[model samples]
Target: MSKQVMLAASAVAVLMSCTVNAATEIQWWHAMGGSLGDKVNEIAEGYNATQDQFVVKPVFKGSYPETMTGAIAAFRAKQQPHIVQVYEVGTATMMSADKAIYPVHQLMNDSKEKFDPTAFLPSVTGYYTANSGEMLSMPFNSSTPVLYYNKSMFEKAGLSDADAPKTWNDLELVATKLLASGAQCGFTTGYQSWVQLENFAARHNVAFASNDNGFGGLDTELLVNNKAFVDHISKLEQWSKTGAFKYGGRASDAASLFYSGECAMYMNSSASYAGIKENMPNTEFGVSELPYWPSVIEQPQNSIIGGASLWVLQGHPKQDYEGVAEFFSYLSSAKVQADWHQFTGYLPITQDAFELTESQNFYQENPGTRIAIEQMTAVTPTKNSKGLRLGNFVQIRDVVDEELEQVWSGKQSAQQALDAVTARSNELLKNFERVNSKS
Candidate 1:
């Protein structure tokens, strides 16, 4: 009895091991944390359950910059993951290191996956595409900035939650009322550079950088001190002095401020919707289009994306590439993308996915959830509004953040701070251009 039982159990164990060994494992290094990280793992689990040939292994590698840096170190050591999630700010850096990446379009084509760039939203994909119209990476979790306000705070200020401020003048009036009503802060924002500078310029149809925001050529220079941009910064400085605007830390630190009811209004990535809902279960909030300046002739131009994308790294096995292509195909499906967009509040990248979400009446039921998607594609993206592709943008953003803080702290004027930011960032860009030229 013991011998037969042992033999049968060993046979089953051997079969299980063989099945595990039969599937190709693809490593995906990502920066998603919290609820978003759960969603990433869920998608991987679903893909694994759907197929016997391939399994996607999603690894959380800290923040965006850290993940990209980790991947570079790994790539040099020939131990990189098959896929890496890179934030929009790192696009130029990734593009410059083309030799280290497997261009996603070529990867899909070589693996015989059906890929149609035209099927994706132009504004969403244009940021990651090459001059030849080749998509270098898969558009994943793409998001745009939107205004989030507390419904209760609006009510407390004798304002209607249903009527959100649409223009900067309207916002100024609202912020005054909010402060008068004893709110801790009238408004706050996350990703100061992205929301206040980059998207701010794009939404005003102004240039944040030269050379079409750096897409036209690598010889781009910073224009953060432009009149339109400086005006916005100056307004923020005034609001900060008035106790109407608070400076939360960079990169979504302000999200918690809104969620915790300290800040009455917030401007942040559309992807923050899920986190807001999850973390502030008791708070009643509303989402709306980002406010515009009424004095600007180009009042309502579109906003650019903020989240990250998946880039395929080089030096992976052929089978791994094939698996990566298959996983990408799964991700690109209408249903999957729609589900992701709905779950995460990121804009649906593909037209089909957006249509699917609409057909389901998700936006109608949710209310205000579609504003980010609308804002991202509201108008044709002019050269100035397409997106920023400045090299060393990650470092540039840090400079902007540091300089802007000086303005917030009242140590420097808005013009002085922005002028300093532009000068320092251009130096970094020049260094980037020179280094890349040699490589």
Candidate 2:
């Protein structure tokens, strides 16, 4: 080979190395595992393929609570990732960390990214929006709870599959039939506090906490001991005694009961659709709106969301913000959003995405996938239905779960358990406020 040709080859190799080194790196720490984790990696790979200027890397960091805690610790050490995924319950904590976050609205405006807040669905975005009407985080996998019933079990019990329980009264009646039909249990639920208490209050148009469920200010207190809650819990306690209702444990543990065909009806997050489909390939199940008590309210109110969002962290360079904003723009496109909604059974964050999914006839082919979207948008959200915002809510939910377990075990009455939960949770809230107020 000629010396000139060798020099040209050396120069080309050097240029290629420089191009690779020039791309900025963005770190994303999240709690997505299993198949969801695969999708997260796929998204990052797709974005990286679209451009050589930036590379977004996704790192799984255990569960939601663990991931948020890790991010907080990292931020204090000045080693924080560029982005983090925080569940809805942690909203109050994140908002209080004013200096630790780069609000999505501000980030987009500063980065000159094309963003329209109105393009997102109001129901999904309302949870992450500030009182000033600015969006705080990018809505990722928003979901709401719904009723999932085994159609085969319903038929065996001589109940019509189309007539899944619409009201609490109907649920009791159906539970009785299901139990009598040789089912191990009538129904079970995951996230007892979320589905049976928090959502129960929203669906009944009753407040779960004072100050508009803590959206107004930090001086909020729990109001879950209200008559609606008391009566509902008391009824569940009675049902438990008769084996009509079974305590399936906490946080999707009861999902096993449904999967094993022990429980005829299961109440869980809409995001569980993918798991259910994958686990029970031959089982015939249908999704329905969460049951409400007609006697409590003439009509049920809209349900709140359950899932997490993508929050941009502070301490990253200005160039990183630009890349993050551009990645977000790509994530929010109709095609991307629609694909995510269809795959994960999470509600599409934007109206355009929902419409795009509809245009593809995804719902027509998969019944019950749209039930959660319909249930969330059925009625305009009032203060009670907007969603909860309480400091230390992750711990507050644990308190609620503990107290509720007491009621299930007959160690405490419904009123006693809820009253205890309120008292304990309020003390945690007070501490959170006292510390954050100073900051």
**Model number with the top TM-score:** 2
Residues 252-274 of candidate 1 have per-residue lDDT tens digits of 88777888788899999888887
Local lDDT at 278 for model 2: 82
Q: What's the C-alpha lDDT at position 427 in model 2?
A: 99
User: What would you estimate as the lDDT of candidate 2?
Assistant: 0.92
Question: At residue 372, what lDDT does model 1 achieve?
Answer: 88
- Model 2, span 154-225: residue lDDT tens: 999999866799998999999999989998898888999999999998899999999888888888899988
- In candidate 2, where is summed lDDT lowest over 10 consecutive residues? 13-22
Backbone clash numbers for all candidates listed:
0, 0
User: Which regions of candidate 1 are displaced past 4 Å?
Assistant: 1-21
The estimated TM-scores of all candidates read: 0.93, 0.95
